[model samples]
Target chain A: MESVLDIKQLTMDFGGLRALDHIDLDVKAGEIAALIGPNGAGKTTFFNCVTGIYKPTEGDMFICPPGKKRERINGLKPNQVTEKGMARTFQNIRLFQNMTVLENVMMGRHCRMRAGIPGAILRNRATREEEQRVVEESYAILKKIGLAEFVNEFAKNLPYGAQRRLEIARAMATEPFLLLLDEPAAGMNNQETKELDELILRIRSEEKISILLIEHDMKLVMSLSDRIFVMDYGRKIAQGTPEEIKNNPAVIKAYLGEDIDA
Target chain B: MNTIKELKKSFLIALWFMFLTFPIMVIKVNTVEQTIDWRWNRLAMVGIFSFFASWIWRYLLQRKEMGQKRAEESETPTLTFQQRVLQNPKFTRPALVVICIFAAIFPFYFSMYQVNIMTTALIYVILGLGLNIVVGLAGLLDLGYVAFYAVGAYSYALLNVHFGMGFWACLPIGAGLAMLFGIVLGFPVLRLRGDYLAIVTLGFGEIIRLILENWNEFSFGPSGIANIPRPGFFGIKMSIHQSLIYIYFIMVAMVIFTIFVVRRLQDSRIGRAWIALREDEVACQATGIDKTKTKLSAFALGATWAGMGGVVFAAKTTFINPASFTIWESIMILCIVVLGGMGSIVGVIFGAGILILLPEYLRAFSEYRMLMFAAALVLMMVFRPHGIISAVRRTYQFEGSPEKKASS
Candidate 1:
C-alpha cells in the first residue's frame, strides 16, 4: 500500500517532559490506522506533532500525495499543515460554537477560496458564486454526515456524538488527503461507537482519504483499524494488523494487554 | 375608501410642506435665542404631518414604491423570523456601495451646514472602525480607546505648535504616540478578558483625561490648544469659504482609506487569528496563534487609526482639548459599533451616520432630540439586536481547483 504519511525519529518534548519519545509510524493511503495508547501514552501528542499543533522537537515527517515522492513536512503551522492536505479534530470537539454547523464546515473551505479580501468585500461576481458554492457544499457534507437537519443550528447545541460527526464533516470540508482524529469515540456510548465504526469505514473508502485515529475503545479499534499502532511511555511499541498486535508482548505491556478481550 | 385616505395623505402633503418649511420660515435657526412657542409648535406640526402622511401611504401606496426613493428600494420586506435574521442578500452589497458613493458625493449637493455634519459623521466613522478592531474583530472590550484619541490630539497639538510641523508630518507622529500608549495599556490588561478588560480600559481612558486636565504647564489646562492648522492640499486650506467640495473630498478620501486598511487587516491570516482568538483564545493558541502578539497587534492597529483620526479632527476643527476627547466620546464610538454590528465594516459607518447626523435634522426638537435618538436606538435594537449588518459569510468556492463552484 502507498504511504500517505511517514514519521521517522519523531521526538516531541515539553521542556522536562518527553510527551513523545523517539518513535516512528506510517499510515498507508486509503486505510484506517488506529493509534492505541494508555492514558498519558502521548497518542494525542503524536497526533498534534503530526498536525503541526506542536512542532516536533526533532524528526523527519513526510507526506506522499499518491503518485508523487513523499514531500517532507515539518514545523509548519496547523493551518499551513492543513493547507498541505492534512486536517485534524481535537480530543474534545472544537467546532465554532456560535457558527452554524454549515458555516463551521464552510470555514474549512477558506483554504480553497480564490477570492481575496478585496474581491469579497467588493462583492464581485466570482466571490458571490464562490460563497454560494461553499454553502451548497457544506450542506451536502452535512447531509452525508446525517446532520443536514441541524445544518443551521449552532455547533455547541449538537449532541455529543453529532458534534463529533460534525467535527469530522468540517475537517472533511477542507478536502484533506489525511484526517487526524483525536478520540472520535470519546464520550460516545456503544451505539454511537458502532455507528462511528460504520461511518469511519464509509469515509475511508468513499473519500479515499487515510485516517489516523486515537482511540481508547479496544473493540472498535481492533475491529476497524486496518493497521494498529500501540504506544507506551511515549514510544511506539508495536505496529501490525489487529491479530498480530493482539499477540505482541510489547503491545501487551503497553496499552491493549489490559483492555483486550481474551 | 383607501383612495380617500390616500387623498387625505396627499392633502397631508401640504402639511408636510408646512412641517418641513415652517421652522425655517417662522424662526431662523442659529439665532442663539428663539421663542419657546415657535420651537414647540414647529416640532408638533412636523410630527402631526408625518403621522397622517404615513397612515395614508401605508394603506394607499403599493408595497414596493414607498416614500423617499432611497427607502423605497432598500427597505427590507417583512419576512418570517428566521428569514429576517438569516437570509441571503440580507445586505445587498451593490446597494450599499451605491449608497456609500452617494454619501461620499453628498457634500457637493448639500448646504455648508450639512457638509459640516457629514465631516463630523466621517470622524465618528473612523472612530467606530477603530473600536471595531478592538471590540469587534479582536473581541477585546476597550473602554479606553478614546484615551488614544486624546493622546493623538495632544501629540499633534504639541508637535505642530512647538515644532511648527505640518499636519502631514504630525499625523504619523500622533499615530505613533497613540500606538505607544496602546502598547503600554495592552501590556497591563493583556491577560484580562470580557468585562474586566472593559473596566480596565475605562480606567485608562479616565486616567488619560485627568492627566490632560491637570497638566496645566504643557497641556494649557482646561482651555485647550487653539488655532491649530487645518490640512491643505499644496496650499489650499479647506476653509469654510472654499468650495467645501475640497474638504468633502478629503473627508471622503479619509473614510475610504481608513475602511480599506481595516478591511484588509480583517481578511488576512492575522484577521482569522483574531477571529479565532475571539471565538476561543485557548484554541487559537493551541493552533499556534500567539495570543499576546495577536492581542497587542489588534490594540496597536486600533489605536493607530484612532490616533490618525484625532490628528485630522484637531486639524479639521483647528482646536484640541481634553474636553473633546471625553469618556463620553469613547462610549459613543463603542455605541456606534454595537448599533452598526460588531465585526462589520459597513455596520460601524451606518451607526456613525445615524448617531451623528440624524440629530442635525432633529435640532428643533431641542430637549427631545436626545430622547428621540435614544428611542430610535431602542427601536433598532428591538428589531435587529445584532446590529444592521451581522455575519459576513466569507466562503471559498475552490472553483479554480475544482469543477463544482456554486453561483452566488
Candidate 2:
C-alpha cells in the first residue's frame, strides 16, 4: 500500500528541551495507525508539528493525496496544511464554542469554498448556490455522525462524547485524505468508546481515508489500529502489528507494563 | 423586617445621590457677576427629591425581585407581555412599519433644530453599526475607530477643495481611503490580542489626530478645512431648510443601506469565519481559516461604513477639523455599540438615539450632561453590563416546527 503520510527525521525543540526527537513515522493509504505512549511522550506535540501548529526544528513532512504527487508540507501554515488535505482534532475539545454545530461543520468546508467579499456581498446566483451546497454537505456529514438532531445547538452545549464526535464530523467536512485525531477517546465512557470504535472503522472503510491517532486507551489502540508504534520520552521504541506490540518487552517496559489485559 | 431592609436600601441610594450632586447643586454660576453663587435652597430641594426618588426606586426593585421569586417557585416559564409582542411577527412587523413611517415624516413635523439633532443621532447610528462589525462580530476591540471617520471626512474635504469632486464621487473615494487606512493599521496589530489590541488602536487614533493637527500643509492644521461643499439635489442649490431636509433624507437612505449590507454580511460564509475567529483564533486556523485575511476583512469592512458616515458628516457640517475626531468621539461610538447590545443592529440604533437625544433634550442641565452621561454609563455597567438589548444569536433548525423556525 502507498503511504499517505511520510515523516522523516522530524525534530522539534524548545530551547534546551527536545520535545520531539527525530521521530520517523508513516501511515499507508486507508490504514488506521495508532501512536501509543505514556504521559509527556510528545505524541500530541508530534501531531502539532505535522499539522503545522508548530514549526519543526528540522524534518521533511510529506503528504501524498490519493492518486496525486507527494508534496513536502513542512513549515506551512496550519490552514495551508489543512488545505493540502490534512485535518486534525486537539487533545482537548476545541470546537467554536458559540457557533452552532452546523455552523462549525460548515466552517470546515471554508477552504473548499471560493466565495469572496464580492460574491458574499452581491449574493449572486453562484454564491447562493455554493452556500446552499455547503449547508447540504455539512448537514449530510452531521447526519452521518448522528448529530443531525443537534444541528442548531451550540457546540459547547453538546455532551462531552458528542462534542468529541462533532470534532471528527467537523474534520471529515474538510474532505481530508488523512485525519489526525489526538486522544479522541480521552474522557469517553465504555459505551461511548464502543460507539467511537465502530465509528472509526466505518470512517476508514466508508470514506477510504487513512487515520493517525494518539490514544492512551490500549484496548482501543490494539483493536482499531492496523499497525502500532510505541514511543517513550519522545523516542519511538517499537513498531509492529498490534499482536507483536502487545508482547514486545520494550513496549511493555516503556508503556504497557506487565499486564496486557489492563 | 422587610420595611426596615427597604428603608436601609433607600437611605444608601439617597446618600449616594447626595454625594454625586453636592458640588453641582450647591455651586451655581453667576453669569452676571462672574462669581460663584451659593444656592442653599436649590441644594436642599435636590437632596429632598433624591431621597424620595431613591425610596421609589428601591420599592420598585424589591417588587421586581419578589415577582421573580414567585415565578421561580411556580416552575412554569411565562413570557412577559413585552416579550410576547417582540416575538410575534404579526405585532412587531406592523409596529416596525408604523415606526418607519413616522420616522419618514418626522422632519416635516419637527423644527430645523430638532431635525438637525435627529440627523446627528442617525449619524451616530451609522458609526455604531460600523464599530459593531469590529468589536461585536469580529471580537476585535478597536478603540481607534474614529480615526477612520476622520480619514473619510478629510479625504472628502481635501478632494472637494482641490479637485472639486462632488458628494457622489467623493463618497466612494473617501470610503476606499478609509479602508486602506484600516488595512494599514490592522496589519501591524494582527498579533496583538485584547487589551494590547485596544491600546495599539487607541494609539493609532491619537497618531492620526496628531498628524492632522501638526501636518499643517496637507490637513490645514488645527484651523481645519472650512467651507466644504454640501451634497446637492441634482444641480439645484436649495435654502437652509431644504438643505436640512435633503441631508436628513440622505442620512435615512445611508442608514438603510448600512443595515441591509450588515444584515447580508452577518449571514454570509465570511461572517461565519469572522465569528469563528472571534470565538477561537487557534480553532479558526485549525479549521482552515486564514486569520490575517479574516481580521483585515473585518477592519476594512467596518472602516468602509465609518468612511461613508464621515463623508456625510463633512457635507452636513461643511467643516473638518482634528478636534472633531477626538478620543471622546471614538468612546461615544463605542458606548453606543455597548449600550445597544453588542452585535445587535436594532440595539445600536436605539442606543445611538438615547445617547445623542438625551443630551439634546436635557439642555436645561447642559453643564451636567457629561456628568449624567458618565453616571448612566457606570450604572449601566454595574446593573446591566450586556447593555439595553442583548444580542439574540441566530441558529439553524431542520425543517420542522414553524415556531422553532420563527425563533431561529
Candidate 3:
C-alpha cells in the first residue's frame, strides 16, 4: 500500500527542552497505525505536528494521501489540515461546551459551508433544505456514534465516555480521510474500551479512513492497530506488526522505563 | 396538496406578494396628497395582510413534512436574521429581498421626522454591525466601543475646525484614529476575558469621556465645537437643501450598504475564523488562527465602522460634544447589539430602531418608555437569549458539507 503520511526527521523544541526529536514514521492508505508511548514520550506532539498544530522545528514530512493526493501538511493551519482531509481529537476534550450538541457538530462543518450570509440570515429555500439535510446527516452520524439522544444537550452535560466519544464525533464531522485519536479509550471502563475498540475499527474500515492513534492501553494498541510504532523521547524506536511489537525488546524497555524482568 | 391547504397557501402567497410589493407602489410620488394616501394604504394593507398571512402560514406550516416549521411555531425561532439565514436558505433570500426593498425605500415613504429618526437608527445600525463583528462574530465583549466613536468624531471635529478641512477628507482620518484606539485598547484588554474585558472597556469609555470633558486644549472642553459641518452629498446639506426625506434614503442606503458588507464578511473565511474563535479560543489557536490578528481585526473592523459613523453623525447634526459620546451611549449601543441579537445585522437595526426612535415616538410615555423598553428587553433576553435574531446557519444542498455535529 502507498504511504498516506511520511515524516522524516521531525523535531520540536520548547526553549531548551526537546518535545519531539528526529522522529520518522509512515502511515499507509487506510492503515490503523498506533503510537504507543509513556506519558511524556511526545505522542501528543507527534499528533500536533501531523495536524499542523505545532510547526516542527526541523522536519520534512510528506503525506501522500490515498487516491493520488499528496502534500506536506506539517506547517498548515488546523483548519487547513482539516480541509486537506485530516482531523484530530484533542488529548483533553475541546468541545464547544456551551453550544448544543447539534450546534457543535455544525461548527465542525464550518469550513465546508459555502452558503453566503444573506442565504444564512434569511434561511432561503436552498439553505433551509441544506440545513435539514445536514441535520439529518448529523443525526445519522450521532446514531452511529450512539450520541443521537444527546443531540440537543449541551456538550458540557455529557458523561465522560460520551464526552470523549463526542470529541471523536466532532472530529469525524469534518469528514476526514485521516483521523488522529488521542487516548480514545482513556478513562473508560473495560466494557467501554471494548466498545471503543470496535468503534476504532469501524472508523478505519467502514469510513474508509486511516487512523494514527495515541493510546496508553496496551490491549487496544495490540488488538486494534494493524501496525504499531513505539516512541521513546519523541523518536520512533521500534516499528512492526502488533505481535512483533509485543516481542520487541526495545519497545518493552521503553514502556517499562528500565530493563524488564526477564 | 390538500384542498384547504392549497386554497390557504395561495391566499397567503397572494397576500405575501402584495405586502412584498406594497412599499414600491406607495412611496416617492413627490406630491403631498399622494404620499399621505399611499402611506395610509400601505399601513392598512400591512396590518390586514399580515394578520391573514400569519393565519394562513400557520395553517400551511402545520403539515407533517415541515417539522422544523412546526418547531419554529411552537417556540418562535427568534432567529436573529443571521440564524434564520443559516438554518434555512429558503426563508432567507426572498425575505431578504423584501427587507432590502423596504430598507431601501423606507425613508422615501415615511415622514421627515420619521426619516430623521431612521437616520439616527442607521447610525446605530452601522455601530451595531461594527460591534457585532467584535462582540458577536469574534466573541469579544467591547464595552467602550463608543470611545472609538468619540475618537472618530473628535478627530474629524478638531481636524476640520482647526484646519478648515472638509467632512469628506476627515472620514478616513477619523477611521484611522478610531482603528488606532481600537488596537491600543485591544493590546492591553485582550489579556482579559469575558467580564474583565467588559469592565476594562467600560473604564476605557469613561476614561476617554473624561479626557474629552477636561481637555481644554484640543477638544474645546465642555462647550463643544458647533457649525461642525453637516455631511453633504453633491454639495447639498441634508437638513435644508437636500430635505431630510432624501437624507432618509441616504441613511437607508448607508444601512443597506453596511448590512451588505457585514453579511459578506459573515460568509467569508475570515468570518468563520471569528466564529471559530468565538466558539472556542483554544481550538482557534490550535487551528493556527493567529489570535493577535483575529482580535485586532475585530477591533479595527468594528472601530472602522463606528468611526465612519461618527463622521456621518457629525455631518448629520453638524455639531457634537463629549456628552454625545457618554457612557450611556456606549451602553445603549451595547443594548442594541445584545437586544438585536449580537452578530445579526437586521436584528441590530431593529434594536437600534426600537431603542432610539420608538421612545421618541412615544412622547406620552416618555418617562416610562425606557422602562417599557427595558422590560421588553429583559423579557426578550430571558425568553430569547439568542437575541431577536441568531447567527443563521445556511444549509447547503451539497452532501460534502459536514453535518452540524451536535456538541457532546
For candidate 3, the per-residue lDDT at A118 reads 54
Best-performing candidate as measured by DockQ: 2
lDDT tens digits, residues B1-408, model 1? 467867676667756776677757556555456533346576566666776766655654454244334443432223334334444475566666887889766876778877777788888898899889888888999988899999888888888888888878888998899999889999999889999999999999999999888889988988999998777678764456463456556768778888887776675545655776788765454434456777898898889888988888887778877888788889889989998889888789888977787777777777896687687678667556678777463533322312221110
- Model 1: residues with Cα > 4 Å off, grouped in runs: A123-140, A189-191, A248-262, B1-122, B141-225, B231-274, B281-308, B321-341, B344-408
Q: Give fnat for candidates 1, 2 and onward, in order.
A: 0.05, 0.68, 0.13
Q: Order the numbered candidates by lDDT, best leading.
A: 2, 1, 3
| TM of each candidate vs. truth | 0.63, 0.88, 0.63
**TM-score of chain B only, all predictions?**
0.74, 0.84, 0.74
* Tens-digit lDDT track of model 3 for A148-223: 7667666776778988888888777778778888888889999989989889888887998899999988988888
Give model 1's DockQ, 2 decimals.
Answer: 0.07
lDDT of 1 at A70: 75
lDDT at residue B327 of model 2 (Cα atoms):
96
Return the top candidate by lDDT.
2
- Which of the predicted structures, 1 or 3, would earn the higher DockQ when compared with the native? 3
Ranking by DockQ: 2, 3, 1
Model 3: lDDT equals 0.77
Error of 2 at A134 (Å): 1.5
